[model samples]
Target: MSDNFSRPQHTAPLTPILQLVNSAPIVLVAFFAIGLSWWFLLIGVIFLVVGGFGYWASWQRRFFWLNEEGELEARSGILFRRSRQLRISRLQSVDILRPPVARLLGYSSLKIEVAGSGDSRVILSYLSVGKAQELRSEILALAKDERTSTQSAEPADHWKWQVPNGRLVASLVLTTSTYFLIIGAVASVAFALVEPGSGLVTLALAVGGSTISLIAGITSLFNFSVGRNDRGIAISHGLFTTAHYTVSPIRIQAICVVQPIAWRPFGWYQVAINVAGADQSSKKSGPRVLIPVVHEDALPELFHELLPSWNLEIEDEWLASAATSRWRFPWQAARLAVSLTSDLFVVRSGALTRRLSAAPHERIQSIRITQGPWERKLGISSLHADSVPGPVRLRGRGLASSVAVHTALAELDRMFTARKSRKSEQW
Candidate 1:
C-alpha cells in the first residue's frame, strides 16, 4: 500500500486559453445582450483575460502526488495555500469530464470522489484525455490490489453496452418533462385565477423553469453509455459537457431499478445506484443513472453482466408468495415484491414510480424489524436493510409469518458479521 510518485507542479500548460474558451459562449451572449459601449466592452475583455490568468497562476502552484501511505496529496491555492489528502482505500469513483472546448483542445477533467459528505476531493482539469483516463484507471486499480509501481500506457478496455440514442431521448422526454409541464400548466392557471396582474409574471417563470429543466435533462442524457473493464463498471455520457464515471463492484452499496407508471406500458425502466461514499449532489437523477431507459427483459441481463452477485430470478417466486395479508394497505402492497439471494437482497415497490432496490449483505449497515398494531395482529413485519443516508430506503413491508421475518433478520446479521470479520482480517 505504500508508493510515492509525484508529478511536476504546474497547471495543464494550456489551461489559461482553456479557461477563455470555457467562458467564450457566456461572454459573447452577455456582450450582445447588454450592448455595452466599445470602451466598456474592451474593459470587460481585459477583466476576463486577467481573471483567466489568475486562475491559471493558482493552478500552477498546485501539486498532486501519491504519498507513502497510498493517499493522494494535493497542495493548492495561491493566497490561501490549502493542502488535502484522500486515502486510496476510501476512494469511491473517478469521473472524467470533457466539455466541448476541452475536447476540442484534446483535454479532459478528472473528478475524484471519495466516501463521504461534501465536495472534498481532487479535480485536475484540462489534462489530455488519455492522461485523465490513465490516472483514473491507475487510482482505481489500487483498491483491487492489482496495481504496481510501473505504469501501463492505457487502461484495459472491456466494452459492455451503449444506451441507444432513441431510448435516451424517449426516457427523458416521457418522464420528468411531462411532470414539469403539467405542473407549469396548472400553476399558470392557478396564478391567473388568483391574481390577474401578477399572473403573466408567474406563468412566465413557471414555464421558463420547466423548459430549462427539460432541456437540461435531455442534454445530460446525450451520448449516455455504460461498460465494464478490469477495474469495474464504467459510465460515460453527455453531449456539450461529457463525463465518464467508474465504480468498482465492491463499492456498489445499493442499486435501484425504477419504472414510471407512464413508462410501464413501454416496459422501460431506469436504474440508479448508491456507491459507498458518493452522492450525485443533483436534484435530478442524472448523477445516479445506471440505465436511462431499458426494457424489463433487458434488466436481468444487464444486472448479471454489471453486478453478477445480485440475482433477480428469485423475484418471480417472491412475488408469488408476497404477503397477501388483507390488513396490508391495498394500494401499495399489491405492486410490492422482494427477492433474496445469498449475497444480495432486492426490494421491489412503488405504484406510479415502480422501484426495485437491492443491496449486498455486507452493505447493510443495520437491519430492523418493525411491526405495527395491525401487522402484529396479522403476524407480519416490515424488514429494512439500512445503509448510509440516501434519497430512498430499501425495504419490504407486510411480509407474512413472523417466523419468515425473524429468519431473514437472523440471516442478515450472520452475513453482516462474517463480512466484517473477513474485512478486518484483510486489513
Candidate 2:
C-alpha cells in the first residue's frame, strides 16, 4: 500500500461486480415477474445488461486523489464528465462505511463531507479495507493541516460512553412504535380468529412493517459507542453495515437532549447534535445521533466531553410563554420557555417528549422573530435561533412580543462577541 494518492487512483477492480451483487434484490424481483409472462423475460434481460454496463462504466470512470493544493478531488461520470474538489479547511467530517457485501469482500467506502454542501457528498467506494483506512487517515491529517506519517501509530481514543446491548434492546422495546406494533399484532390476530381470511392482509402488513423497523433500529445502533481522541470525537456503530465517523467539535452547530414520556421513568435521554455538511434528512440513525441512549446522570459529563468550552447549564431566568399563549399551547404553555446562558441559547418545550435544545453563541447563524396575524392579536411572538440543519431546533414559541424582540437583540450581541473570540482560537 503506497501513501501517495497524489496520482488519480481508480477504486478496486471488483467494484462493478460487487455493485451488481448489491442490486441482487432488484434482479430477483425482475426474475420473479418474468415467471408471470414469458414475454417479460426479454425486459429483465435488457435491464440486467444495461445495469451491468452502467456499473462497469461508472467504476472505470470514477477516480479520486489528493491534489497539490491539499484538496480532495474526485472525477466521475462516463458521458457527463463531472469533477469535484473540496478544500481541506472546509472538511467537516470523514466516515468509513462497510456494507455487508463490502465487509465480506474486504472492502470499504470513504465519505467526505464539507460545510454548506447540503445533501451533496464525495464518496469513494469499494476500496480495499486497509487502503480505505489509510486514505481516511491521510485525509483527516491533511484536513487538520498536519503532516501524514506512516510510522506513527494512530492516536489512542478515550472511550467515554458505550450503550450496553441490553439497554439498547430495552430502549427499542419501550418505544412508541413497538407499543403500536404490539397492538396492531393483537388486533390482527383477533380479526383472523373471527374470520380466517379477513385479517390476513392486515396481519402481514403489520408484521412486515414492524419487522423492518425493528431490524433497522437494531442494525443502526448495534454496538453503539463514542470516544474522543486528539483529532476529534469518534462514533462507531451498526451491525450489517458498520460505520465509523470522526466529527470535529467545532463543526457541531447545536445539540438537543430529548426524553420521551416513557423514558422519563427510567431516566433515559437521547442526545442528538446538528453538524454542518451532514445530511439531516436521513431517516436512519446517522451522524446526527451523538448518543442514542444515556442516563440523566451522565448528561453533564457527556456534554462536557462534546463541548468543553461552552457552559450548557440551564439558567434560572427562563422566560415562559405569555399568558395569551394559553389559547395555543394550552397545557404546555407553562413548560414552554427560553433561556439564555452566558455562552449558550436554550429552548425548552414539549409536553410528552421533553426537548432541551442548546446552541453556542458562536454557532448561532441568525436570530429570527416572527409574529403572525393571530400571534399579533394574542400579543405574542416567536424567536428562532437558526443553526445548521439538524434535529436541534432552538426556538422560543409563544413569547410576549417585547420579550422576543429583546431576546433577539441580546442574542445577536452575544453571537458577535463569541464569534470575535472564536476567530482567535484554533481548531
Candidate 3:
C-alpha cells in the first residue's frame, strides 16, 4: 500500500485518438442525409460542434507514469478534469488496440487495466506501434517487481489470449446485414446520375459515404482482442477509435457462453462476462468481451483463467429432452385428439442439445401456463420459464394437457424458491 517502487517517467504522452474516432458516426450521418433538407446541413454543423468540443477535451487529457513512485496516472477533461492513480501491485491486464488509421500512422493505443485499485483506468492513445509489444513486456515486469517485494507467493504472470479466427467473416456478416451506408451510397449515386437537380452534391455524398464504411470495416477487424492476465479479463475493440474495458474477478456477476446458429457449424461460441460496472447498452458492446468468438473446446481454458469458480459442467444441467408424465400423457392425448381433430398440434423441448436437467428451484425467475380457446377445450397448456435475457418455453402439446404444464411450473417454482431460502450448499 505504500507505493514505494520506482515507476517509469512519461515519454511524450500519447495524444487522444479515440475522441476523433467517436466523431466518425456524426460525419457519416451528415453525408447520408445530404439531400433530405436544410436539416442535413444543420446536422453536419452539430457534428462539427460536438467533434470540436471532443478534440478540445482530448487535448486536455494526458496519461503518464511517475518514475520514483512506480505508479500510473491519467489526467484529462475539458469541463471536468480527472486523474486516476494506480500502483503496479494492483495491475490486472494490459491490452493494445490499433484502428486502421492508427496502424497506418504507426501508432497503437495501450490500456493498463487494474483490479483492486479504485478507478485507475489508463488509456494511452498514440503510442508508437513498434513499441507496443516492448511496452507491454515492460509493464508486466513492473507488475512482477511489485509482487516480489510483497514476500507473498507471486501469481503466474502468463496471460491467456483468445483471438477470433472468423473475425473478418463475422465483420462482413454484420456489415452486410446492419450497415445502411452502402445502400445510402448507391441511392446517392443513382440519384446523382439520373435525377435532375444537385448531381454534384449527391456524387460527393456517395464518395464520402463509401470511404467511411470502408474505413470503419477495416478498423473494426483490426481492433478486436480478448485476454485474461494477472488481475482480470480485458477487452479492447474498434477500428478507427477504440474502447478499453477491465473487469475485476470480485465484481463479476455472471458468465454466459453464447452460441448462435451461424456459429454452430464452426463450433464457435462467445464468452460474455456480466459485471456490475459494465455498460450494457448494446448486446455486442460490453464493458468487455473476454473472447470475441472462438471454438467451443477453448472455452474451458478461458473460463478457468477468467472465472475460477465457473463450472462448464453446468451446461449438463440445462433442460433438453422432455420428461414423460404418466397422469398427464392420457390427458394430453385426449386433448390433442380433440384439437388435432380440427388442426394438427405439436409439442417438444426447446433445447437443441439433448441432455438431462433438473431445474434448480431458486434460479427460476417466472413461470406461466397459457391455454388458447382450442387448447382450453382440450385441457392442454403451454409452459414458459422466464429469465433475464428472455423466456424458455416448453410445450407439452396434446399428450399431457393442462395438468402436465401446471405440474412442471409448480415443481420448478418450488425448487427455485426453496433454494433461495436455504443456506449455502453445493450444487
Top lDDT hit: 2
In the range 193-294, model 2's lDDT, one tens digit per residue, is 999977877777877887778778888889999988767788899988888887768777898888878798999999888876566666332477889898
Error of 1 at 31 (Å): 5.4
Give the alpha carbon lDDT tens digit for every residue of 270-318 in model 3.
5544454332343433453455566778777776666555443432122
lDDT of 1 by residue, 1-427 (tens): 2232455345478877788777777766767877778865886778687878787787688888766677777888888998888887777667787888888878988877666666557887768887776677668766455343443343455767888888788777788767867777787778878877666776677667767887797788788788887666778788878867666667667888788878978989888777655555654322467778888788878877887766655633563224555457566677665666656677878767888788777777877777788887777777788865555578777677554476476657756675866452110
Off by over 4 Å in 2: 36-63, 71-89, 114-121, 146-155, 178-211, 279-286, 421-427
* Candidate 1 least-lDDT 10 residues: 1-10
Per-residue lDDT, model 3, residue 369, is 63
Error of 2 at 384 (Å): 1.7
Model 3 lDDT, residue 255, Cα: 39
lDDT of each prediction vs. the true structure?
Answer: 0.71, 0.82, 0.51
